[model samples]
Target: MKKNKMSFETSFWTGLAEGNPFREVDAFFAFAYLDYYKQNLSEMVIYSRKTKVYKQDNPSDVFVLYTAFNFFLKVCYGLQKKSKKWKVKDSLCCETVFHLTSLTQEEYENPFIVFQKAFGENTLEEFELFLCQIVELSLSPHAGDPDAELTTPYIHLIKMLDAGELIRERGVEKIRKTDQMDPVA
Candidate 1:
């Protein structure tokens, strides 16, 4: 994934200034996923910095990010419920960053609906690959789902990462500064 010439915020500002926040989340998700996740980063510090201070205050934007991220997770891994209490987990926030870059929703929910089916019976690592695949597919010009057919790859790459994956490489030291806090159920 190559870095886009412009940040998602560039396009977002124009749309937001015009009162169109519909596809911002979708575009942001695409942009961030490509730049931050797919391509290797400089020590992962760049993305790490972008994350810690970021917050999603808008309900609509929250809905979009969570819906998309959760959809991706579901598609790749399997159907799972999300904890209502938010945490600073990279697995969660990485996807959220994708949504934060832009604003707006696609009119049809076919992509999301199609992915929901593919999510069944997948392991976490396998789900990661599926996620990579989904981003690749979505970026392609020929990509789209009218009927939203769900197909199975039958590949299992879901290596459930421990705290290491949750914290991210950059946050490793930061974790030592804090104590474990029970997650809100």
Candidate 2:
């Protein structure tokens, strides 16, 4: 008998549909996007200099952005899974995040418009800041454990997304700063 291996995409879709709490889909997408970006870092640097024209020429950038949006969807799913004690407003926020994930790439390209249509401008701004913070943490040097080198970034990303404030408040930032300032004695 032969065993079949499930592809990452298949597993991802299945996890989404099944509402699996441990799948860590956001982490997977984040790591994938980061790997892709690292591979094309030079191109991105060049493209940054020509932002207006870059979008017109670089289709992959759009795909990468869409991938990031997918991560956001996964984050919402995780939030929903863990929202058992959440207030009505928190539940509604989770629903809004999940709904935003349904928007097409064309729709998400103008995120302000989509957000305004679904949530409000304040939510849009906050969401954007959240994404920016996630990306900043993803690119940091000590985002993951040294023993699990390949999965370090993904681990950090998953923790950040799951906890929401892990990157901002008493999470990775605090740990990293403390580790830097004081030696483990």
Candidate 3:
């Protein structure tokens, strides 16, 4: 999907500074799902980076990005559970996500600071979207596979996020210098 003029950090803080992180996520979803993105698959999305021709970014990319950050909410929820720093409350609208809250604002935007302190900034990004998909596929019909409404992928995802701590314990730039990750794909 196309990036917005507003950086994610800005949009994230606008809502989060008010104690409702979900509002930020929903704002992104709203901005990305605008009418322009609702065009036919063949329609031009934006100018290509290397050429004048318009870019036909798949509409599905928005969904992928949405799912990715949506999963982030859960990750924060799970992390907060153990750290007990944010004092979060459950989301009544959708149990899958928890709206993380914080009273103080540090110069740096590190809601996951507790984990970061213990594990380095490895969790600055998501664990692995590809690996998660493969594992879920191999296991087949996991918790929320139309059942575990079933299951909480967020908690499951947190389990993997914790692995970053283990990886950082060994001390490296990141997990395998492994980047280009995240999402339900």
Candidate 4:
């Protein structure tokens, strides 16, 4: 939740130059999630401005950013699905999974494709585990003081999933039966 003054553009450029784009994108997402948790409009505005500048200055980087963001969302969706207390909307989760699967089929793939290859038939399970690792990382002491009431985006997300708060009202279906006269009678 702390304001991240580090320049995302610089980090991305450095990572790109060093041939380590994945790490940079992942780090950016972590910071973005922290900002989101804080709900700090000013910080978010600054972040957005910087991203826009970066995207304009370097168009190819947009695809890298898109892939990274989609991967993050896919992981989040997986976590939501795996939670016993909560379930992501079937359509939404299915669509994300489908997209990720398609990406894995491509020759030049997102970094998550490595997970798909490694997990084979149990890819979904592996993805959920990967997301669990992220949750654990977010909960680490260096991230913040766990006892603090203020929740980071990662904490809020985990709490929501565990609490089943994401489930829709229609998640539980009701069935009704009424007696009727037999037509053959």
Model 3 lDDT at residue 46 = 18
Ranking by lDDT: 2, 4, 3, 1
lDDT of 3: 0.32
- Clash counts per candidate, in order, are 21, 0, 2, 0
TM-score of each: 0.20, 0.27, 0.23, 0.23
lDDT of 1 by residue, 48-144 (tens): 2232211223324322333343333432232121111222223323344344222112201112222233344555446545444443333334433
State model 2's lDDT: 0.35
Which candidate would rank higher by TM-score, 2 or 3? 2
lDDT of 1 at 58: 30
lDDT (CA) for every model shown? 0.30, 0.35, 0.32, 0.33
Candidate 3 clash pair list:
46-55, 148-151
- Who wins the lDDT comparison? 2
Q: Which runs in model 2 stand beyond 4 Å of their true positions?
A: 1-16, 24-27, 30-33, 37-52, 55-57, 73-125, 128-185
Question: Which 10-residue window in model 4 sums to the lowest lDDT?
Answer: 161-170
Q: lDDT per residue, candidate 4, 1-185, as tens digits?
A: 89533222433322432222233334434444533432332222233323223224444544443334334434433333233332223333423433332232331122223333333433443444433333333333234333433223333233322222122211322223559888995
Candidate 1 versus the native: TM-score?
Answer: 0.20
Score residue 42 of candidate 4 by CA lDDT: 25
The candidate, 2 or 4, that scores higher on lDDT is 2
